[model samples]
Target: MKVLMVSWEYPPVVVGGLGRHVHHLATELVEAGHEVVVLSRRPTGTDASTHPTITHISEGVLVVAVAEDPAHFVFGEDMLAWTLAMGHAMVRAGVALGKPGLGDGWQPDVVHAHDWLVAHPAIALAEYFDVPLVSTLHATEAGRHSGWISGTINRQVHSVEWWLANESDSIITCSVSMEDEVTELYGPQLPPITVIRNGIDVTTWNYRQRAPRSGPPRLLFVGRLEYEKGVQDIIAALPRIRRSHPGTTLAVAGEGTQFEWLQQEARTNRVLRSVTFLGNLDHTELLSWLHAADAIVLPSRYEPFGIIALEAAAAGTPLVTSTAGGLGEAVVDGVTGMSFLPGDVEGLTSAVREVLDDPAAAQRRAEAARERLTADFDWHRVAVDTAQVYLSAKRRVRHPLARPDIPQRPLPGR
Candidate 1:
C-alpha cells in the first residue's frame, strides 16, 4: 500500500517517543515491500533544507519535511510550537502529498496521521484526495494528567482530540487503556479505536545490553522531569533507596517545568549530589548510560504505556515503576520487573532496592526482559500490525460509511 504518514517530529527533532516511532515504522514498512512517505517538521542537527521540509531516505524510508515558520513562536523558546502552527502549515505543505500536479503515477492509498499535531493535515489530505483517513491518538489530557484537565487549554486539547477521533475513518492509540479512555470520554461513536502500543527499534537499543559496565549499581530515570511524571516521588524514594542501598546512584534525564522542584526534593533529601540530572541525552549517550544503570525507573503518575520501558527491557534493564494506567500492561510485574502503588514512596524505593541489592534476581529479570522485548515489542512486528490497521481503515474508506463493527482486525502493536 502507498501510505502517507504525517507527524510533528522526525529523526533529531524528537520531543518524545512519537518521532522515533514514526521513523522506525516508516523504515520497516518500506522494508516489507510497501511504499511509505512521511511529512514531518524539520529536526535539529541537520543541514537546513532548501525545500520547506527536506525529503530523504533513511534505511529505505522515504521522508519529506516542511519547516513551519518559527517566527510565530513565543519569546525565548528554541523549539517550534509543534501543534500551535503545525496544522495550518501542514495543510499548506501537503500540496505534495501524492503525485505532484505533473501527473506522476504514484498516489497514496491511505492517509495516516500519527497524533493530534498532524491530524489536521491528515483530515485535509483525506478530504481533498478522497482517501482513507487513519489517525493515531498518542495521548489525551485526561489520560496524561490522570483525568485532571481544566480551563481553555485543557478544553482545547480535549476538543481537538475528540474532533480528530470523530473525523477520522478510524482511530489508533498506543494502549488498550487509552482506547477505553477515548470511548468513555468521547462516546462509542468516536470511530473504532485500535490499540497499537508504541514499539522501540530493538537493534539500536540493544547496545545498552551489550555495553561494558563500570561502577556501582545504578538507578536510572529518563523522561520529562515533571509533576505528572512522578519525578518528585522518585526523589523522595531516593532517601530510602540510598539508606537501604547507599552505593546506588540515580541518573535523572530529560527536561521539563518541574525540574526545579525535582532538584529541590533531591536537595532537601540531601541526595542532590547522588542524583545526576542529565537533561535529554542523545541515543548513543542514553544507551551507554542505560548500561551503567541496574534498572530504569518510570515512576510516571499517568503513563499511557511507556516506550522507555520497552527500550529498557530491550537493553536488558530491569524496571521499577508505579502501576499507573497502561504501564502495568507493559511489564509482567515479577517477570519483567516489579511495580508498586503509583504514589507510595516506600513502595517505589523498595522496588528499586529489590533489583540493586539482589544481583542474581536482577540478572534473571534482565535476561527475561530482553527476551520479552525481542519477542513482543519488535518494531517490525509493530509495523506489520500497524499496516493491518491501515488496511482495515482503507476498507472502511472504500465503503464510505459502514457498520461501526465491520469485523475490524485487532488493534496492532499491543
Candidate 2:
C-alpha cells in the first residue's frame, strides 16, 4: 500500500511522543512491505536553497520536509495561522507529487493524518486524489484541559479537531477512552473509529540489563512539564516519599512550558535539592536513565495513551502511573504496574512508595510488563493492525453502503 502520512512533528523536529510515534509507525510500515511517505515541517533555519528536502529512508519509505519562514509569523501571536501554513505546505508537497515523473511518479493510495495540525491538507489531498482519509487523534483539547475549552487559542484548536473528526472517512485513536472522547465531542458527524494502542520498540529499550543500584533510588518522569502531565503532583508527593525513603530523588526529563513552575514547586515543597531537572536528554541518554532508574513514573492527569509507560515496561523498569484517560487501561493495576488516582497527591505518594518498598515484587511486575509488550505491543504488530485499518477505511470509501469490519460506536442520539 502507498500511504501518505501528514503530521506536524517528525524526527529532528520532534517536540513530543507524537513525532516519535509517527516516525516509528512509518518505519515499521515500510518494514511490513508498504510504501510510506511522511509530510512534516522542515527543520527551522534549513538553508532556503534546500526548500523541500526529500529524504529517501530505505526502499519503501521517504520523508519530505517542506520549509516555511518563521519571520513571517509570531510564535504565540498566531499558532492557528502557523498550523494552517504547515498544513498548506503539506498540500503543496502533495500537489507537486501529482506531477508525473516526480520521484518515480508515485502517488499515495491513502491519506493518513495525525492530529489536527495536518487535518486541512490531509482532508484536501484525500478529496483531490479520491482516496480514503484516516485521521488518528492522539488527544482532544477538551480532554487536555479536563473538559474545558478555555482561551481563544484552545477554542480554535477544539474547533479544528471537530472539523477533522467530521471530515475524515475513518478515525483512529490510541485508546478506548480517547475513542469515547471523540464520540462525545463530535457526535453523529464522527466516522468509524479504531482503537490501536501505542507501541514501542522493545529491543531498543532492552539494550542493557539494569545493574544493582546504591545510594539514592532514582525516580524518573519523562514527559512535558505541563499541568496536564501532573508533574506538579509528583513534586508534591516527594515530601511524603522523603519522610520514609529519605534517599529518594526524582529526575524530571523533557522540556516544556511549565519547567520554571516545576522548579518553583520543588523548591516550595523543600525537595528542590532532591530533584534533578535534566532539561532534555537525547534518545541514548533517555534510555540510559530508563535502564538505570529504580522506577519510572508517569503522573499524567490527561494522557490519551501513556507511551512512556510502555517504554518503561520495555526497559524492564517498574512503572507507577495515574488512572487518567487511557493510562487506566494501559497498565494492569497491581499486576503489571502500580496505579494512582489522577490529581490525588496522597494516592501518588502511596503508589510510588509501594514500588520502592518492594524491590522483588516490582521487578516481577516489570518483567511481566515486558512480556506483555513483546506479546501485544510490538511495532511490527502495530504496523500490520494499522494496515488493516487503512484497508478498512479504503474499502468503506470505495463502497459507501459497506459496513466497517471494526464495530463503530453509534453516533449520539442515533
In terms of TM-score, the best-performing candidate is 2
lDDT of each: 0.75, 0.83
On lDDT, the leading prediction is 2
Window of ten residues with lowest summed lDDT in model 1: 405-414
TM-score of each: 0.88, 0.92
How well does candidate 2 score on lDDT at residue 46?
58
Clashes of 2: 0
lDDT of 2: 0.83
